[model samples]
Target: MDDKKVKILLGKRIKQLRQSFNFTQFVLGEKIDINQRQVAQIESGHSFPSLSTLVKLAKVYNCEIKDLFNYNHLEKEEKVKENIINIISNLDKKDAQLLYAIVKVIREK
Candidate 1:
């Protein structure tokens, strides 16, 4: 992906993680030792965090730096579907059945 796209995806992933932890931008900023406006800028894709800031963010989120970039869910739908199909095609029969059951349960919810 291009730099801009990557930044946007990273921003989305950060926002997702922050929300999952029930943190507001102000709260997340405090935890990461940044100001609320800085957190807003980062989450809006208007600014990129420095390496040190990334480390602080990872620490606050209780995840590795790599997890901050795990934005596969932000990819194009067609690409996501292709990836899912490829993964499913490679799964063993038992794993496939397990995956099917999990998906069914998720759908029922």
Candidate 2:
């Protein structure tokens, strides 16, 4: 992906993680020792966090720094579908059956 897209995706992933942890931007900023405006900038993709900030964020979120970059769910729907298809195609028969069952359960929900 392009730099802008990567930044946007990373920002979204950070926001998702923050929300999952029940943290507002102000709370997250306090944990990371930044200001709320800075946190807002990061979440809005207008500013990228420094490596130090990332380390602080990982600590605050109780996750590895790499986990903060797991932004595949922020990809375009078509790309996501293609990735899922590729993964499914590589699965063994038994795994495929299990996956199908899981998907069925999810769909029912």
Candidate 3:
């Protein structure tokens, strides 16, 4: 995969993992000594974390660093949709409702 795709997949994975742990970007950043903005950027796939940062994040999430870069599952568009569904399924009803509305609006455009 291209570098941009790698960044996006990694970002999505990190975001899903972070949400599963109930860690806000700021809280996770604090735990890892990164700024919240950096976390946000990382989650948006706008910035690729350095190797040391990846190690810290992997340790925080209790996974191997290599697991963070597993791109096979992320290669499919359906996998991306599935990941989004998984994330939304974990959210509160109100947020999910809002997201549904937003998705409807976007799809209608």
Candidate 4:
């Protein structure tokens, strides 16, 4: 892919990862010590992240660097995860605790 396309692809992958982790760009930028505007630029493909930034992103997303470039259908999965987080968050503490336990059990398997 051309450099522009590559940058956009990276942005999309980063966005998907961010959504899956329920992180706003501002929050992610804070973790990586960059301004949220820079994060927005990166996510919009208006700028490319440096290697160090990429490393930080991979660490924050808990994925291999390669995975960032390989994202496709994962966008749907990320959206689902985002929705689940939003729904679970609105539940009462007792219900949220039960949901968490169920998720943990499912994840452990």
TM-score of each: 0.68, 0.69, 0.68, 0.64
Q: Per-residue lDDT for 1-109 in model 1, tens only?
A: 7988887888888988899999999999988889999988988888899999999988887789998998877776548789999999999999999999999999999
lDDT by residue (18-73, candidate 4, tens digit) is 88899998999998889999998988888999989988888987888788788556
Clash statistics: count for each candidate: 0, 0, 0, 0
Whole-structure CA lDDT of model 3: 0.90
Q: What is candidate 1's CA lDDT for residue 101? A: 99
User: Whole-model Cα lDDT per candidate?
Assistant: 0.89, 0.90, 0.90, 0.85
Worst 10 residues of 2 by lDDT: 71-80
For model 2, how does the per-residue alpha-carbon lDDT over 1-109 read when each residue is reduced to its tens digit?
A: 7877778888888998889999999999999999999998988888899999999999988899999998876787548789999999999999999999999999999
lDDT of 3 by residue, 6-66 (tens): 8988998898889999999999999888999999999899999989899999999999999
Q: By the lDDT metric, which is better: model 1 or model 2?
A: 2
Collision pairs in model 4: none
Better of 2 and 3 by TM-score: 2
After superposition, candidate 3 runs with Cα above 4 Å error: 77-109
Steric clash count of candidate 2: 0
Candidate 4: Cα lDDT at 47 = 94
In terms of lDDT, the poorest run of 10 residues in model 4 is: 70-79
